[model samples]
Each structure stands twice: as C-alpha cells, then as structure tokens.
Target: MPASTREAVRTAVLADSDTRWKWGALTARRITPESVEPTGFVLRGRATPTARQLTETGVSDTAPREVTGAEFLREVRDAEARGEGYDVVVLALVGGAVRALLQGLADLGLARRPVIVTGYVGVVYEKLTDGLLLRHGADVVLANSRHDAERFRAVYEGVGASAEPVVEAALPFLGGAPHTPEAGRDTLVFAAQPSVPATRAERAYVLRRLVGHARLHPDREVLLKLRSKPGEHTTHLEEFPFQKLVRELDAPANFRLVYGHMGEVLDRTDLLVTVSSTAALEALHRRVPTAVLTDLGVREALGNHHFVGSGLLTSFDLLDRGLVPAPDETWLARQGVAADTPYEAAFDAARERVAALLALPALPPVTPYYTAETAPGYLPGVLARHRLDVTAPEPRESGLRRVVREAARGAYRQGVQRVAPVIRRLGEL
Candidate 1:
C-alpha cells in the first residue's frame, strides 16, 4: 500500500468516547464517522450500554446511522472487494449474540481473518466459540486479567492466535485526589449488587456470618456500605429486610449504615468484603484488607474460590478464625500496584502487541486515545449534565448514569438493612 493511501485508509472503524479516547490518545488515528465509508467495520459483541453512551455523548457527526444486520453483511462484502483494504475485523463480544454475529461474519467470508477479544472465561461454549474464532480468523485475543489471559492461552494452545493480558484499570476519574483515610473506624463494606435470586441468598448468608462475627467482638463496629443501582430504591430497598432485622435483634450500638463518598467510606473500613466481585480486587490493590465470602455457591462457581485458594485472597473462613491480612504496604508506599517493570514498559509491550496485530497481514491495531478537553457529547459532558460542546443540557440522563453517581449511598443502605437481621440471628446459629 502507498504511504498516502495507507494513511487515508487508517481511520477508526468504531468511534465512541472510550474507543476515541482509548485509541486516539495512543495513536493518531481519527475516530471514524458514520458518514465516512470505512475500509471495514469492527463490531464488539457485548451490547455495552456504556460504550453506546460514550458514542452518544462524544462522537461527532450527529446524523442517525442505523447499522442493521443486512447493512453489516454488505459492509463486509464491500471490504472484501477492496482486497487488502481492511487490516482485519475485530469483535469483542460474548453470549447469544456471538453465534449470530460469527455466523454472519462467516457467511460473508469476513471471519476468515480477524481478531477477537474474548470476555471472562469458564463458560465452555463461549470459550470454544472464541477458540474457533481464533483458529479461523483471529490474530490476537485480548484478555482483561492474567487469569483470563492464561485461560485463553490454554484454550488455544498451538493455534496461530495469541493471548495477551490487558488489565482493566479504573478510569482517571477514580484517580482523583485520594481522600484522607478515616482512622480508628472498624467497618466492613460489601460493594456488590446481587441481581440474581441465587446471589441474594448467598449474600444473605455472608451477611449473617459477618453479623455473627461482629456480635462476638462487641468492641468493634460493623458498618455496611451498599451501593444503589437503577430500580434499587424500589426493588432492592423494599425486598431487603433491614428494618425488620433491627426490630428483631438486640443490635450492637456500633452496627450502623454508612453511605456516600466511596473513597472515604473505604478509607474508614478496616476491610472490604464481597463474593467474586471485582471490588475485592480494587480493595486489596488499594491497600485495604479484603475477605472473600466463599459460602456463596454462585460466586464460588464464578471463580471466587480460586482467589480464596490463591494466597492473594483472605477468606471469610480466615476472618471467622480471627484473621486479617495486612494491607499491601509495598504498593501503599509506592502509591501504585506492583509491576516488575515501570508502567511505560508495560505500555510499550502493549503497543508492540497492538503493532504486531496491525502489522499482521490480517488485523488492524486498536489505537486508544484520551484528551483533557471535552468533545461534543463526550462522557464528561453527559456526566456533568452538559452538551457535547460542554454547554447545554439533555432532557434525561441514563439509568446507569444515575447509578454510578449514587451507587455508594444506595449500596451502603441496602447492606445495613440486609445485614442487621443476620447479625441478630447469629446468636441462634
């Protein structure tokens, strides 16, 4: 390909706040507009409302561009005609839609050479489908964790495709000035929202255990910081039996509900508690002692047990035995998680892998970008209640938008309500 032509063709296949920010900051590639015909389109399997929200807020060119199944099939055909046009197709997808998407891609002959970023592991069908995609088309598959990376590597051993870890760090919003730590407060927070019935049962059991432990140690305070989500004020709050539990038991004076200011809430807590939720990872990495509540069968099935089995996780069993793993003092001293090499080195390695995928006669590299200024309809705008230009207002905000802003408060209340009864009941146990 000629230099000028290659440069002209190197536009982003998908343009959204995250895609634009992630890829744009890393490389000079412009976010592809809906108006412009791409050499080929890249599709992610997950219907990530957040990604769509990013696109809705930040992506320029407001024309309504509806991509139907047929239109997508046509785009692939067009790309195929312009041979050597697309580096490769990429799909970061999961669940039922994956089959239809892959089948469609295959029918169009687009699945012959592409890259696939697989989601979490353990679902056999999803893993097998991902492996098949890799063998048939993918040049590179991105895993979000070291465990996920190793899992994918095992699945596709000896296959042409390769797996690499891309740890999902919290966005810059999380890095805002760390609040001052709260001293001498003995609180434990369960930050996850259990959406399923089975999960609720497990959570109930864990709360019971924690309450029992709290009763035995009357000197210590037990605080529950529950986050609220969409429909939470109605469903979760109403269904959870906090008030009833309080009425039933001779409650400890220290057991109270704390909400709001998550960083502060966490700072006050002696430790964080959860099932197989990512909050465990966040808490430990940030120097908070973490306990994995393993009695939850659902969480255990989802690989929470592995963390407990690993030295990294301190289990509820240990906590019941009066154990508390010290905070990651090394990371706290350095003010960051451990890396054998510096961040720049890890980034360099990531860039090399991305470059390798791009250089492959098969797939285009994902160039991620971030800018300090707000673009039209960008995330900052949506979150801040401003327009894309960072000026006007939209009529309504998304449910998720509301949730992220208010989750800590809601979760804290719910956790207190749910745990109070269990604590009182522990005497019977």
Candidate 2:
C-alpha cells in the first residue's frame, strides 16, 4: 500500500508501570500493521516507573506522556468529538483501572470509539476470574497463550457473557537468538520479580540460595536481573528488594546485580533461573537453558506451580550439582512458546479481528461485566479506587494546581521508595 492511501492506525497505549508499558507498547506494535506506529501513555500512579526504569526497558525511543485516568478519558472523548480519535487503545493497567476506564468510556456514549485492548502483562496465575471479568468489555481481550485463551473464554461463558472478544496471542516481547555456549564465560541469570515471594523471609531465602550458588561456582558469572531498582516501581510492589537483601549477604565478585534489557542479558546467558517470572518463557523461546525454582516449593503464592508439568522446575541444590533440565515440548506448545511457531504469526488473529472491528460503521459502548445495575454493590468501589464515576463529570484542574499536584505525587513516590523503607527498618530495630 502507498503511504498516502494506507490507513494510518492511530494507536494509544495506557500502562501503569514499567513492565506493563513495555508489554503494552510492544503489543501495540505487534498487532498493528507494519506501516503504522503506536503512541504510549503512562498512567500516573504509585506504580509509575522512574525515568531510569522507562529508559531501561528500551521498548520506546521517546518517553510516553503520563496522564491520570480522568485526563486520559477526557482526551479520548474530546478527540472523538473532534473526529480525530485513536483507532486502537490498549489499557495496560490493573483490573480495577481497566474496569474504571470501561465504565468511563461507556459513560461517554460516543457514536464511535476506539477498539479497547487489554490483557495480562505476563503469566495469569492469580486473580484469573476477577481480572478477566474486569477486562470483559474490551474489544479485544488478548490471551498470551492457548492456555490463557481457553481459560478466558470459559470464565466469560460461565457467566453467560459473550466470549467473542477473546483473542489468542503470544507475549510480544518473546524473541532472541538461540542460546549458544560462549567460548570464555558462562553466565547464570536469576530473573527476579517484585512481589512473588511476598514476605521478607521468602525473599531473603531466595537471595541466600542465589548467593550460595554463586559461591559454589566462582568461575561462572551469576547475575541478579532485577525488574526495577530499589526506588523505582514495576508492575508490583517490592516490599523486599533483592538489591537490599544482597547487601546483607556476602556475594562474590562473579555474582553482581546487573540491570539492563533482559534480552541483552540473555544473549550471553548460559542458564536462566526464576521463581515464576515470564522471563522463563523468553528463555525457553530462545532455547536457553532455564529453571523454575522448586527450592521455594511449588506453591501458587510463589507462582512456580504454573510450571509444574513443564519439566523446568528444579531446586538450587540440583543446579549446584550441574543438573540442566530441558522443557517439555507439549507443555511449551500449550504455553504459546512452541518452537515451530513463528513469533510474527502470533498476532495474526488479533490483527484480523481488529481490522474487522475497524471496518464497522460504529462500535458499541464499552460494557464491562460489573456495571452499576448488575453489580450495584461491587462496581462503585472499583471505580472509586481509581477516582472514576460514571454518574458525574470528572473535575478539571488548573495549570498551577496540576503542577502542585504532580509535585505532591512525586514526593509521595519518593517516600514510598526511600523514606518508608528506612522507617520500616527502624521499626524492626
């Protein structure tokens, strides 16, 4: 298609944190045609990424504009009223936020609106029903795997809701050169999550085990690939950071905290280890030797249970003893990490579904499962948490007031990252 004649799909992605921003932006690019580019927006909140965190993802060349839920909704409504609105809007937010936005959009009652897209950033191990229902109203509720797609449809269908919007897709960021043994150094990377092993004790135990492994193998390079720095936030809260825990332990020179793009780190990695991070999928995609830690036990809380039949679950003791496990092909197929499937093809169904939606005369109002009429008791609280109300207009703030509010938000984030941790530590003493 010629540049002039081609339909330029104006895409917008709203994400809450660094990881979600990366996932949403990449997903927007993947689902759209090659000729179109996607714009990104970071939802201003506690989980908002720091400048460093955004830069480290390496997903976007430019920084995304940050907006509150009301601000974003107003922008979309005003744009549509002006006949210059986005063609696709990806909501990379938590379930409540997504639900709030759906209500907000429904309240707009526009003759035509953007095709809203939403999905899990990674593995859908917990809150499956609640999250899926909250995202029920999107034009396309993407499932990162065949496993997820089935589960999503079942939930909707069970509730007697339409499952037409559920689309099968793979994690957009899954790609890298197949792992090859390097001549000089062998690297082991433990992909860390923010809140998986939620307690301080569990996190400390994992850190000790990692340090012990590093001590046992002095020659091999070991890396703690953290999702975010101590002050910076990702998808989840980090009550206990590995960076903080490592300071208490005696780690060797070969084992250090390295932060950068995961793919770049995987390029030199001989083994990839994680409790239950989506990084395991990326590693398996690249044929990298990977392990899902069983040392912490195969518990749902830790999320390692998701890999139970995958053949990647093992303990640090086995890893120290030179045991390298290969993933089961059947399990990989179900997880959308099939060796034979091309990554490019993963978004075909989504693209086609989106194209058809775009071709329609007018799209209907966003109708989430939890509405004021259906779930009178539940819906209000969800909307209220994000400060969204379908019954009233969102309040507009003056420029000076906006500046002061942003400054206050910055201070609050600083306290959460820096001061609060210190206070907690002091309390412990």
> Any runs in candidate 2 off by more than 4 Å, and if so which?
1-6, 389-407, 418-429
lDDT of 2 at 152: 95
Instruction: Give the least accurate 10-residue stretch of model 1, judged by summed lDDT.
Output: 26-35
Instruction: Name the runs in model 1 displaced over 4 angstroms.
Output: 1-90, 103-116, 121-136, 145-147, 158-181, 184-186, 193-200, 210-270, 296-302, 312-322, 326-337, 360-429
Q: What are the C-alpha RMSDs, in order, of all predicted structures?
A: 13.6, 2.9
Query: Compared with the true structure, what per-residue lDDT tens digits does model 2 show for residues 1-429?
Result: 111223688788999999899999999998865426677789988998878889888998899988888778878877777866778899999999999888787777766677889998999999999999889899999999999999999999999889999999999999989888979878999999999888888999999988899999998899999878766778887878888888998788989998999999999899999999999999999999999998878998998889989999889999999898989999999999855778889899998888777777777667778877778999888887988543457667899999898788778877987788779889999
Using TM-score, give the best candidate's number.
2
Per-residue lDDT over 1-429 for candidate 1, one digit per residue giving the tens place of the 0 to 100 score = 321234433322331113322222222121111113333232321121232333332323332222433454455556557764344333323322333344445445553333332232211212353343323223334443344445556654444333342322111112223224565556667654333223445556656666776787776777765443222331122344342334445556666655444455666666777655454544654556677654555343455554533344565677767786654444332322333333333234333444454445544332211112322333233223311111123235499976774565445654554555467567769
Q: Which candidate ranks first by lDDT, i.e. highest? A: 2
